[model samples]
Target: MTAPSPACREDVRRTLAYLTAVGYGGTAMEVWQWLYRPSRAWSLEEVMVALDAQVAEAKVDVMQGRYALAGHGARMADRHERYLSSDKKMQSARWFLRVMRLIPGVRAVAVCNSLSHEMASEKSDIDLFVITRSRALWCVRFFALLPLSLLRRRPGHRTRHPICLSFFLSDASLDLRDVHLKPDDPHMAHWLLSTVPMIDDGVFADCIHANAWARELFPNAQSPRVAWYRRLACLRPLSWSLPFWLERVLEQFQLERLPSEIRTRMNGSTDVIINEHMLKFHTNDRRLEYRERFLSLARVQK
Candidate 1:
């Protein structure tokens, strides 16, 4: 389904709603109270007020200190739903995570792609990059995510690759992050910065990724242009696959990860794999890595 423009806000809202339902035992106030980090520095009252705006129109009753997103949020998902990437997808993801938490074996869950800017209008999949604790439960989790993945795929979506990015699912031998993420290579982080939270219990933090780092690495790079040309190359007469050449061109900036976001976008627009957005942001706190790396590199280079 064509994800809506306000998918980010809507999904986040619905996700907060669902998590509020599960996270604090159906306590919307508690969910907000917890999800938003308590900063004694910021105006707590204002934060609570702004969050309350979500329930302004809904029929959710905050009895004592708990509330549900039942009335307004659910109604919007049902009535206003235009695409799977709409707030509905977020609701589905939230529900999926809620279910995961209840499952005895599951460890933690995360929601990536919540803020992805794809190249295609048609999505390839709603990537719910799940992280769990056990290596043996990999198969069990696959079976667990099977029906849900099918259910979560965007409308008109041909593929259903809800990738489980766990050390267990990938390779128990390597660090889970290493197995899921290609490497914390300077090339990758330099480009991505989009991220969101799923069920962060300090196992992971709210992280984001962007393609700006790719631009930084290839300072003279005009990837969006290159992406267009490479896309044309794939369709032109007497052409083999354009990605091979494009990958060669983008080797320095991790053509693999760099193209990931774009490819995911392409899956939306055309049938071609447009390199999946050049970045796949997992929901973790990778904020300082960028700054720290720059400083560390500057020191070494000097």
Candidate 2:
């Protein structure tokens, strides 16, 4: 391979540093796919050559075909173990999506966070981003939580591979830039890019179109590859056609029953948003923390 240009080498190092901060590594193709170059797209051969140059300079390490920071080569082993755990969690997520599909108003369901990145640990609960019909947000949340609560598969009930129904948005409100942490939020940008849709009734494309800002952060990143099993469709419509008044009734009922913690935190900020368009119940958001860590690591490499 020809010697990589200085700009290509810097881009490769920054990408590896970001991944290292997130507790994982990547293969050559993975590096190219996740490459952090907002200005221009780089070819796979360019990224590979840059990675090879970094390895030669003792700035990066490769193990079993995976690349990491110089002293973080062990992350490849951890990543492999987490990949196995992620496979099992994905199987469980698929089963849960089948059940969710039976409910009304569910427009799209995508796996997010660690699981979407294929880096979930054994204890990591499955995190999902759901999209419901406009004005049916609260009603859909009620039904979606009902079955999981009864089966003891929710976060507090199930210790291993539990499901976390934290974030939800209505189809009318697909742009997520408002919920981001102000000026520059790298984590949220990557999160939006990483979501893997399990059940999409044409809403996934709309959602992506709504958040085109993510392309500015990762110009070369493509939409996540949809698995064959995740292509299931909701053939028969059910109670989704209910009147708007009933939706308001269900919304009030669910609001009253919300846990005290969520009630107190509701609408306080983006971390625990609660309204008609979106229902995000994350009491402990870590986007700021991850952003800081990534910046710190990237600066050190520079």
lDDT of 2 by residue, 1-302 (tens): 68898888888888888778777688998888888753467889988999888999999999988999898898777777888899889887767788778778888888999998888999999999998889888777888889888889999884688999999899998998888887777778888888888777778889988988877777777787666654553222243545689889998898889899999988888789988899999898888887788888888888
TM-score of each: 0.31, 0.93
**Candidate 2 ranges beyond 4 A from true positions:** 229-239
lDDT of residue 120 for candidate 1: 12
Alpha-carbon RMSD of each model = 19.1, 2.1
- The sequence of per-residue lDDT tens digits that candidate 1 reaches over residues 159-227 is 433433321121122122221223333323322222233443333322221233332322322112112
Those runs of model 1 whose alpha carbons end farther than 4 Å from true positions after fitting are 1-86, 114-124, 136-140, 149-193, 206-302
